[model samples]
Target: MGDYFIKALACGDSLRVITTVTTETVREAQTRHRTWPTATAALGRTLTATMMMAAQQKGDEKITVTIQGGGPIGAIVADANTSGQVRGYVTNPEVHFDLNAQGKLDVARAVGNAGFLSVVKDLGLRENFTGRVPIISGELGDDFTYYFARSEQVPSAVGVGVLVNPDESVKAAGGFIIQVLPGADDAVIEKLENRLKEIPPISKLIDAGHSPEQLLDDLFADHDYRVLQKHSAEFYCDCSKEKFGDSIAGLGTKEIQAMIDEDGGAEVTCQFCETHYQFTADELKALMH
Candidate 1:
């Protein structure tokens, strides 16, 4: 599929597993942000993990994840909802470095080891649920794994990866999340952990053309699992001229007049998508109310 994720219950409903292939999704992000290989890998991993996290929520619920690692890449932010729509950006998109000892993108170096990962769940409540944890591994996958165990208090394993081609284009991007539910059998958890250790990296699996179903099958090799749901996903941003216009209007008439007099117009670019929206002098006057 172009881009999609699947949710399944394995080990007799004692464990919840999610898998996704996001090649095209990450490609779009790379093109939009012009991210280098290391930057692409970092942002792609964050986006994939955010999308999977959103799968756990109900209707209209949303999840926002932020990472700031005190590295050259600065902060990474991504948000997603139950509808499988995700969008994100990094503070710097051109940072890059040589591969690490394992010949990987060296995401940890670019992301740094000093910082925090924070998550906010908007459950349509009076106050959103927020969790923050120290950055354990700048590689992202381990960081998210730690997030679940410490923040949500759910024993979870998260794996996310991205591969960038020689031309700095995204080759593959995907990940998996396995959560051990209450009453999970100890033996089953041990088996699942062993299976994870044996499987290839998630990005390599995606590059090898493994579908979400196949990924779960690989993870639950000798075990039986039932697919619970599937959702189409994409790097989507809902920003619009009207939305930016409302923001400009919120700035009051005095600021609107300044744009008309000094610049003759105002150009607003979305940080996530880099899409620019221009408001001419006449348009600015229209929002002066």
Candidate 2:
């Protein structure tokens, strides 16, 4: 189907699982960023995982995820809201490499083995929540799991994946995050760990046309879980000319004057969605006031 995710409570409500299918969203991102295969996989996985984390909040709360490895891809950035609005970009989208040993995208090499994954959550509170963790694997899913356990103190399992076509189109993109609560028993954790191992890569399932709901069913077929909510996700960027104009005004009167006198205009392209906003010399002059 389109992009969507299901949040569920399993193992007698002692575990939380979020399964998301983001094929369409990933495809849109590749188109906007013109990402190569490895770059697409790296950025797509980050986007999917960030979307799942954003679903943890409510109202106007938002989440921003930054993956800044020392690789050629530079940084992968994504921001999402509880309502499923998401926008992201890779600093270098043209990086590519041969497949890994498993004949899979070499995301780790493209995203690098060094650096940190930082997540900031704007919970509409006086102080936002920020979590930082070392990058165990540039595969992204494992790194997120580590972040939850070590940084956020939540024992979680994240399994994000993305597949690309020969033409660099996004074939599939999806993932799941499972967290054990304090009440979780050893048996419950063991069962989940075993199930996770037996399950195929999340991207494979998505390529096989599995929906988020179906994925949950397959993963926890024996467990009695309740669906908490479902969110429709999409590639949405709300950038505008006025927003960029205001930013230009914030650059002070001299800078605005420089754009008017030297360049005769100002053109700002959004890094997230690549939306271009152009202001004529007259418009730049107007902002001087």
Candidate 3:
């Protein structure tokens, strides 16, 4: 299936929910980054969460999520816009670890227990909005749930999971976010909480052929959920040779000449997508003009 996400409201609009299927998107990221199984799980979870959060924005608005856990996987940064475009990178994609005690990817060990998760929103305003909170759980989902309850002051539940194949490719990846809107009744919150406690992990559900709509149905149970919007999501990077050429041009004539004298050319690689752009001696000379 293609990558997609949905936004919905349940229980008379007292709850806001977002769910996504990101297996293809995560596979794209794994191929671009060549991430190990553990690294794939960590980065995939964060990317999925970022897409859901970005869906809350308006026109031309975007959101960036940073996970700086001070662990071997280093930092993960991702940006997503309302248009469903997303790009991200891990500071150390080669990192890996054995499964944890629960027979799951050891994301906490790879992400560490220190540092914070920061979020910045670009709303096309004079000043961008930013919020941050300590990384209470390096598992990502709990960290985002903590972020919403503490930083955004919204009671929310977040579930992000990524399953890795035997060959280290992404098998299933997905997530869900459910928030309690204002004036939600105590019974509604209690029942929803109870239901959440019984559902399987998000990755397991996706592996079982559950769509984003079905995930929401599982979350909301018998309550009717009205789908607000549906968007196709993907692992998209906005890096191009022309953009790299401009950056090389900005380095001035001296830098370009040095490259010609020392290495005979310049090779630029995008950190986000691992795409390489090469400029030969002739190309460099033309760029100097």
Candidate 4:
């Protein structure tokens, strides 16, 4: 009913699947950013991928995904941690367009296909795991599939979809990630490839009131799968007044004083959740020390 994702391994551990139903999450994001239909589609896809990627990790692990295409939508950024929290924003959320030939949201045109998709993961290591790949489709799903194959060397199929209502609200949003594991049987791969080709759009599945577990069941209908874990996903931002204060402090004493002198205080709004945090001159002065 809200939003959730399930992780599982199937075909004798020769394949990995992550299925998510993200309608509510995307709705919240659209409301927060006031994203149009095309922008909503682009952002929703990226957020779905972020949720799946974070589900692969645990504890304090973190991940940041950035997509910069020269399209009207500009850049899309989403971050998630192992705690089932994800937040993101688009640089140009007001973008919209007539439906594409397929009668879809025309996400590729809005996202552009001229930039790169980058992922940075902080896994409690000295240096984070960083991956970058060119934006092949600007549709995000194909780009992420290519990212896994090209960057992580894992052959994957990522299907993310978002249906926008006439009112610009998200009608249904969801995604699935299927990866081919090492030494996978050729038969297994072939079977999965067939399923991938025949399966309906992920958004359609979610809109039909299917849960993540049910999506997996539909994908691997013939083969029995093992559920690894399930997690609640939502539009979550960790920004706070103190975090904004620290950022203001990082701007140094002079910038803090300038905020106090020029504006009498400071107002900062987070791009991810559109949450605003205000600090008065008194608060700014304290950060100056």
TM-score, per-candidate, Cα-based: 0.99, 0.98, 0.96, 0.97
Q: What is the lDDT of residue 27 in candidate 1?
A: 94
Poorest 10 consecutive residues by lDDT, candidate 3: 216-225
Is 3 or 4 the stronger prediction by TM-score?
Answer: 4
Clashing residue pairs in all predictions, respectively, total 0, 0, 0, 0
Please list the residue runs of candidate 3 whose C-alpha ends up more than 4 Å from where it truly belongs after superposition: none
Q: Between candidates 2 and 4, which one is better according to lDDT?
A: 2
Q: On a 0 to 100 scale, what is the lDDT of residue 197 in model 4? A: 85
lDDT of 1 by residue, 1-289 (tens): 5799999999999999999998899999999999999999999999999999998889999999999999999999999999888999999999999989999999999889899999999999999999999998799999999999999899999999999999999999999999999999999999988988999998999899899989988898865999999889999999999999999999999999999999999999999999999999999999999
lDDT of 3 by residue, 115-220 (tens): 9999999999999999999998799999999999999999999999999999989999999999999999999899888998999888999999999999988787
Q: What is the lDDT of residue 273 in candidate 1?
A: 91
Question: Which residue runs does candidate 1 get wrong by more than 4 Å?
Answer: none
- Candidate 2 lDDT over 38-113, as tens digits, reads 9999999999999999998888999999998788999999999998778899999999999999999999998886
Ranking by TM-score: 1, 2, 4, 3
Candidate 3: deviation at residue 280, Å?
1.7
Error at 261, model 3, angstroms: 1.5
| lDDT pick, better of 1 and 4 | 1
Model 1 has an lDDT value of 0.94
